[model samples]
Target: MLSRRHFTAALALATGLSVSGLALPALAQTDIKLTLDWRFEGPAAGFLLAQDNGYFADEGLNVTIDVGNGSVEAIPRVATGAYQLGFGDINSLIKFLDEDPSQPVKAVMMVYDKPVFSVVGRRSLGITEDPKSLEGKKLGAPPPDGAFAQWPAFKEVAGIDDSAITLESIGFPVREPMLASGDVDGVFGFAFSVILNLKANGVPEDDIVPLLFADHGLNLYGNAIMVNEAFAEENPEAVKGFLRALAKGFADAVADPGAGAAAVLARNEILDINTETERLEMANEMNIKTPYVVENGFGGIDEARLAASIETLKISMGLQGNVTAADIFDAQFLPPAEERMLP
Candidate 1:
């Protein structure tokens, strides 16, 4: 007895047609390479959870998630097809597309609805919660850090006078240490990450101050799941299925961050379960489960807000007026809102 695939091949061979013409994709698993914006920390549990629970497998996908150097680094990796999908800052994606509208990449899912971009500083070093406090301050900024990349606009919206402020070039490894040692008054990075790193460096909680760019009226979206435009065009269903699985994964993570952190621990035993769990909870409250997400469900964006964000980018990132919000994000790949609701 010939299997359906063999029968389809036989029929297609006789009919002078391709096997695909005889049968649509059924149980065939598509291969996907996914790049994460950063290390396998607490926030990554959602992606890991989906993989561990076989959500991607159930969706007929063989997905491999890789740790990325930075959120900005994932853009080219996905654009050039070195990876089929990635989690990265959508603001950076906007800049990438603006430089060349023909780039084969676009955001498919909104993970960090409010964004985690922040300038974390220590109050003991003359820094405070007020964005205006950054004036005359020396701040550490990693060149590839997603949060630092938003400085131009962040400074503009936050109304900080950079003429008096100095930016110190630093690496990711030293961002928190530099701030903890008071070598630099503040650092540009994700809010939760910088906070956690400072805590690990022994900075007191009372001294740590995270000034989020979004709260200063940036209104920009944050990290999102981006796809290779070519791959998405070729396998639309696979993309949809991948997003569906991620939605479930994130929901589960939100429902129980302890389990989510456990998933992260399963990946890297060196990580402290307590620290990772706290990290996941912080991400859930600050970036993921925003009022908008709670109301509209997850993995979707507001067209008007996205459009306004592009306007903000004009001043912040110096976009070339080459692409619009619609050009950067495609909501068609997301599952239905009802299916994306968080716990």
Candidate 2:
């Protein structure tokens, strides 16, 4: 015969409960602050899904994600420790590392295998489907845009004469509006964003022509998940766990993009679900779910291709620093292929 306290303890153990009749406490979750390359739009659905679906919590991580202005802004924010992780342009990260060579930031996960960089133009503005249609025409581009930052590379690869085209520096908010109003012949931007924004501004889809840089000659990788190198060095397991959760989120988003877009809408009530759904679907099919990604799995890059991209940037952008692909990307944190593969 056991005493009352001993009996209660035996019962608690048998029931997988504590002496106080409560479940055991869970492990402490690691907190992470993350930032995105742009607003809570379609492509941001995966990260949002990871947060809302408890994927991050499953990895014992408490993540707080914030919308960012652009990839250029995101790089410096992560490097400066303003954010622990971010989604940003890999080319932009390359340039940053070249300039400083000591910035403790590197891309750990490749998101956009096929970049969205493009030059969008209105057909009525004497811009046709040809890459050279903009000769002697004004091209509007936001000064800090990731697509515009790679213009020189695109120009070199496409064999376009720089002297024949006039460059017009435009703010991001006005890029599409100005093109719709015939204020500029063409604008440089992400293909998905420019096409949708043009349509939203009343420009018919048929009237808009997108000259995708990737289709032409630039084989550059686009945005990626960047981590502060210092942070990664100190917390390797946490970084791996983050990527695992992120891969799961992406896999889920690829299966049913509408669910991913809904995840974004849950966070931002001002967004239009129909439009964002379309955008998310477009991004999924065109960028995220490419045949290469489908074949090789997500979050890993081909070294030879990445090296070629670095060489292209060095020549086209007049980069003086001796930077290599190794300096800009670190694949150690990527989840295993079996885990990242899509269903």
Candidate 3:
């Protein structure tokens, strides 16, 4: 008769079981559907890179990425379980959580340390290099725009009288063109998106002045990776693996934004490589690769700063609820500190 150990080993080999007689499950891939906050632009290259490089596959995940109409729209998609994951504005997620505290969606990673919110105006339109210049100017704002949603907060901090400004509701497709054609004196939008879109619409880059909200007393963090609470609860390992793959992709993008942009171009062949590359670089410098992110690593937030942001949001957005930072973000799903460090 064969020894017990040898017999067990033979049984393991015959049944694809462990030596301890535990049946080994097949390596099953988790299916994840991810929605982006916007089109496949420069900033989206990192996710594309992750997909192209098989980062998701390495973690036993099969991720499908879809373009979204806007950052605000992404929150609802994830909250409704239409998407298992999303890249969206954290502020929008906070507002959604306040309105429906039962919604099982929370930000898992901090992608943009500095909010990309800004007011892009033409210097020729009397917008001189000051936030006060926006007073009395006609501003184009998209109703669903993440930046525009925060305008009340911006108005409060910049000390601008709401009555002094004429607000024109415009669609995203025409916001840049309208600004370039002088249809509006200024517009609220993400700096990187608006700047390049304006340039593409024939606006002189020199004439554009971007008044960043972060510079003007908005301590809010920007976009992050948000996950559906139910999906995360059932598949914590999958969630962690998703973040790990995403961080790897981000780190790779930081090392070579050109390569990252190329990955984006592969997905949408109609995009102009040069323009998208510039947009990606701009987003990295002004939003993603901030000093704080460099020091603390990516995929995490500073608790103190996050609390202060909640207080600012409460005052500026006139938010009425007992919502706190914990409700909006759960950093527990983030990858390890070392794995998130930029190259």
Candidate 2 regions off by >4 Å?
A: 1-26
Decide which is better by lDDT, 2 or 3.
Answer: 3
Model 3 TM: 0.93
In model 2, residue pairs whose N, Cα or C atoms come closer than 3 Å (at least 3 residues apart or on different chains), thus clashing, are none
Residue lDDT tens for model 1, 173-273: 88898898889999999998899889999999999999999888889999999999999999999999999999999999999999999999888899889
> Which sections of candidate 3 miss by over 4 Å?
1-25
Per lDDT, what order, best first?
1, 3, 2
Each prediction's TM-score versus the true structure: 0.92, 0.92, 0.93
Q: What's model 1's lDDT at 297?
A: 97
Per-residue CA lDDT of candidate 3, range 1-343, in tens? Answer: 9999999877776766786656654456899999999999999988988999999999989999999888889998998899999999998887787777899899999999999999999998988767899989999999888999889888898887778899999999999999999999999899999999988998888999999988988889999999999999999999999999999998888889889889889888998899999999999899998988788898899978888887888877767866888888898888778888887
Candidate 2, residues 1-343, lDDT tens digits: the string is 9999999977776766787656753457788999998888888988988878788998889999998877778999999988999999999888889898988999999999999988999888988877888788999988778999999999899988779798999988899999999999999988888899999999999899999899999999999999998899988988999999999888888887889888888878887788888998888887888888989898899988998899899999888767888888899999778889976
Single out the weakest 10-residue window by summed lDDT for candidate 1: 19-28
- By lDDT, the better pick of 1 and 3 is 1
| Candidate 2 TM-score, true structure as reference | 0.92
lDDT of each: 0.92, 0.88, 0.89
